[model samples]
Each structure stands twice: as C-alpha cells, then as structure tokens.
Target: MSAFLSARRLALLATRCPRRTLSTTPRWSADPWPLPHTAQHLSNTQTPSDIPPPTPIPRPGESEETLRARLVYQSRKRGTLESDLLLSTFARDHLGKMDETELKEYDKLLDEPDWDIYYWATEGRSPPERWAKSSVLEKLTIHAKNEGKVVRRMPPL
Candidate 1:
C-alpha cells in the first residue's frame, strides 16, 4: 500500500501542473503569483489586505503637467489649442500654425535627410525662407537625381 501511494504522489509531481498540487493547512504549497503589471502600485508597502483600491484617474483640472504645457515666444505665452497642436506635431506641438502651403511643404520636408525643416517647423522659426534653405522641392530634385529618376518642377510656393 505504501509503495502504491508513493507512486501516485510521484505521478502527480512528475506532471507539469500549473497550480499547486499539494495543499497543507494554514500554509499554501505553491507561492502566490506576483502582482499583476496593471495593478496600481501604492507608495506604501502595507499588507495585501491593507492595500487600497486602485486610485481614480485625476480630472483635467487636477493635472499639473497638462496645465504647464504651453508655447512661448520671447516673454509672451501662447496657450491656444491650435498653437499647442502645432508645437506638438512639428516638433513638440507647434507646427499646426503654418499656412496651408507652408504645412504642405512642411509635410514633404518631414522626409528630408536634414533636420532643419523639422527644427524650424517645431521651433516656429522658418530659417529666413531663402533660396539657400533648399526647399522640399529642391531636396526632392536632388533625391530623384541620386536614384536615377527625373522629377518634374512643382509650381513655386
């Protein structure tokens, strides 16, 4: 009888069961799984039972970081929604303010090798908009030539 019982116990132990197969009074066999990643972490290390329910997400007004995000020019502060979106999209979120043509050019320039267009788009400063700046069309012209393709001229912006 003892040998048969030992064999049964070994059979259960040999199988790869995910849950605890052996349970004892006042103590568990397998340890509890670690806390889930989505579980809210409290600043305190209180017992599991003492842990409070997940915290509620603070409302917009209750957030400090959201309130501090703004666009500034010199000493002036620009806090409108459009300005914020522009600054964020182009660089941080301020690129949305450029005129339709500027935005179209800005979109194309986003793929350029040099970072100047992105820098200017996000910084709210267009490097003088001079011929020396090498517009997106000019850069595309150079790229097409490198790839042995001909690019037709785009009407001047």
Candidate 2:
C-alpha cells in the first residue's frame, strides 16, 4: 500500500511538472498585420504626405492646423470606446497648451496598444517602458483615472 501511494505521488508530480522547454519560435513574421477593409479604405483616403508626421514636434514650418487635425483624429479613434472618450476628452482639454515636445510624446503613446494604455491610465498596471517618457502621458493617465470617478449613467430613466 505504501509503494502504491508513492507511485501515485510520483505520477501526480510528473503530471504537474513541465515536460519540455518553452519554444523560442516567433509567432508572427516581420510583416505588419494585414489591414482590414475599413483600415485600407482610411489609408487610401489620405495620402502619406497629407497625414501628419508622428514626430514629437512638428517639422519646422509645419502648420498648426495639421497638428490639431492629427491630434484630434488620433485621440478620438482609439480602438475601444472607453479609451476613445478618455483620450479625446484629455486631448480636448490639454493638447492646445501642450508644447511641441509634449505633443510628440503623446503621439508616441498613441502608438502603443490600446489595452496597455487603458491599463496604465486606469492604474490597473504600471506604466511600461514605452510609456516612461512624455509628461503628456502622465497627465493623460491621471485624466483617465478621473474619468472613472464621474457617475457613468443615470440610475433610472
């Protein structure tokens, strides 16, 4: 009976332990994800030059209209609705006063995954390396948290 129990324990241990080393193979190739039809349509609708450049500061002689338009578009269209409202409201409040450097950093933050930004903004996760820069992101994160404070909906109609 003791030998049988020992064998059962060994079998349990074997089942729980990892059998092989994790694979090092990359899941995705170097190519960017294929654009869906909507994304493709949006891209085709605007020329590369017509799109605002992603640098923190606008290029020398770049127009304010271009910067404003880009900021509005980026802030409003985050992949999820929650991020969209949070970012857009923050942008509307602060983008006008942000210096060229702040604008650039905000642009970089926009490049990160929406989920990461949402997590950081809500204080659900620490800011990762990509979010380390940019006072703008810091301020935006605070704003996102504040958005959680406001009453979300009327209790009854």
Candidate 1 lDDT, 1-157, residue by residue in tens: 9999999988887786556566556575433543312123111212343444334333344232322232122102223332233323233323334344544443444332232332343332233333236454344333323354333332111
RMSD of each: 21.0, 14.6
Q: What is candidate 2's local distance difference test score? A: 0.67
As a whole number from 0 to 100, the lDDT of residue 12 in candidate 1 is: 89
Task: Give candidate 1's whole-model lDDT.
Answer: 0.35
Q: Lowest summed lDDT over 10 consecutive residues: which window, candidate 2?
A: 40-49
| Deviation in Å, model 1, residue 16 alpha carbon | 41
Residue range 1-157, candidate 2, lDDT tens digits:
9999999999999899957777788766432543323444334323233444335543667667677668778878877766787787777778888877777677777876665566667665566555676577779877776746774321110
Residue 93: error of model 2 in Å? 0.5
Poorest stretch of ten by lDDT in candidate 1? 36-45
Report the Cα lDDT for residue 111, model 2: 75
lDDT values of the candidates?
A: 0.35, 0.67
